[model samples]
Target: MEPKNNEEEWGKTAWEFLTQVRTQSPLIQCITNFVSMDLMANTLLSAGASPAMLHSLPEIPHFTPRADALLINLGTLSPSWLPSFNSAAELCHSLGTPWVLDPVAVSASPFRFNACLELLRFKPAVIRGNASEIIALSMPQHSTTDSTKGADSTHESTDAVEAAKLLAQRTGAIVAVTGATDIVTDGNQVVGARNGVALMQKITATGCSVTALIAAFVAVDKSHALDATVSALAVFGVAGELGMKEAKGPASLRMHLIDALYGLDEAALKSHVNITSLC
Candidate 1:
């Protein structure tokens, strides 16, 4: 079947996902970095999802089974964090729970790249990252990689569209490449969301928090992983744009972004989302 590019349908779908998330209030287990933990949790709360920062191996089995979804982010890759990530991912897989992987700065170090490769075995429902990390993850030929500058993408989002598609095909996961214009693909169908502002980049952990939001949406409806992922990005992008209008700068933008997300309802999502399918 050919992919349809209907803006109205996209908006309706996004609004539906947003409404489901707000009603469901899914519990998201996040094994994210320290830098992103607080903001990610706040973002989840503002979006009407329960956030649990449980990254200890001892508690992995206990939490993984109860959570709606899991998020593994390699932002602060420490020696102790690896075992917990592996355990949570394995448990989530065995329990048939959806999970997301945010390979932050995966292109920067061999350790991070190798860890991501290992995690791919369990299969994540979604992989959210910048263009550099997605490109590095897609290309297995490269040995010493370098496409990021300390968790920041050095490349444009367009540069990783093909890589994201290939990665999604190989992993059977939705790939979301976030930048000036966010792109989401599930190997066959591609979607683009153009509804964010430059101020988003200045705030730390916006990308990571967005991934957590994706987990929440996916938890609500795992069967439609692509749509859920795209909806999460569209919601975040729309909130960013709305936040920018009231923000003085990066600091204020962060606060306003969270507020905007909290204020976002079905009506706001249906009207503000600028999404289209791209086959």
Candidate 2:
């Protein structure tokens, strides 16, 4: 998954998107898992975006309208919380505020999996998840065999490329499968972000944090969902690659990663970003 000769072009494009995010400082409404709330908010702030972890259903009318973008993550799905998510997403649809969906561990159960499918009705701007989750989401709605997995993906990110494409085609959303090589697709063009350190996987909520970051990126762009999604992932990966240099372990890497994202300059981004077209 080495970048082609056009790496510089993609790097600059990504940097341009990040610049837009900083300029806009889009207020992102995130209805995410409790465990990820802190890290996700920190990730958005480090990237120069405002994050609002508002989930109360009553606030949807006022906040959702003002938010530049929204993130609905099923990482901590509950029967009680699904309606608020539905309400928020529906409002985002009506207001045309781009929203992202992170269907964490969709195969773990029936209720959580069905909740993810239901959210697809509004047609999210982007869908980010692991390979197994992507594979599960792309499966026939009636299938029963693709069950029993935890949040962790059983397969490699590359294994779900076809599924990711299929999902994007069916749902009309840019689908991103995150793993060693983060894959982004729009049912046509498939892009792979070859950045980040393997140690990133050890940190809890990194995936959730990245999804929120994607929400921030698309909040600023809104038109080029695929490019925005790729850029967010690549930028996060570049931050991870840089943070790994001074990190003693997963704990320190977490702090350093946020700092790297906060301090990323044109030079480091242009030199380190490795996004490429995937066959």
lDDT, model 2, position 162? 96
Clashing pairs in 2: none
Give lDDT tens digits, candidate 2, residues 1-279.
233347888898789989998998999999999999999999999999999999998888888999999999998888989988899988888888899999998888878879998899988999999999999999867346764366888889999999999999999999999999999999988999999999999999999999999999999888989889999999999999999999999999999999999999999999998888876
In the range 1-279, model 1's lDDT, one tens digit per residue, is 235467678778878888888899999999999999989999999999999998878988776899999999999898778888899999899989999999998877778888899899999999999998899999885457464787888999988899999999999999999998788999978888888898789899999999999999999999889889988998898899889889999999999999999998767777888887767
Q: What does the lDDT read for residue 132 in candidate 1?
A: 89
The 10-residue segment with the lowest total lDDT in model 2: 140-149
* Deviation in Å, model 1, residue 193 alpha carbon: 0.9
Tell me, what's the RMSD of every candidate? 1.5, 2.3
The runs of at least 3 residues in candidate 1 whose Cα sits more than 4 Å from the true structure, single-residue gaps closed, are: 1-4
Number of the top lDDT candidate: 2
* Residue 15 in model 2: lDDT: 94
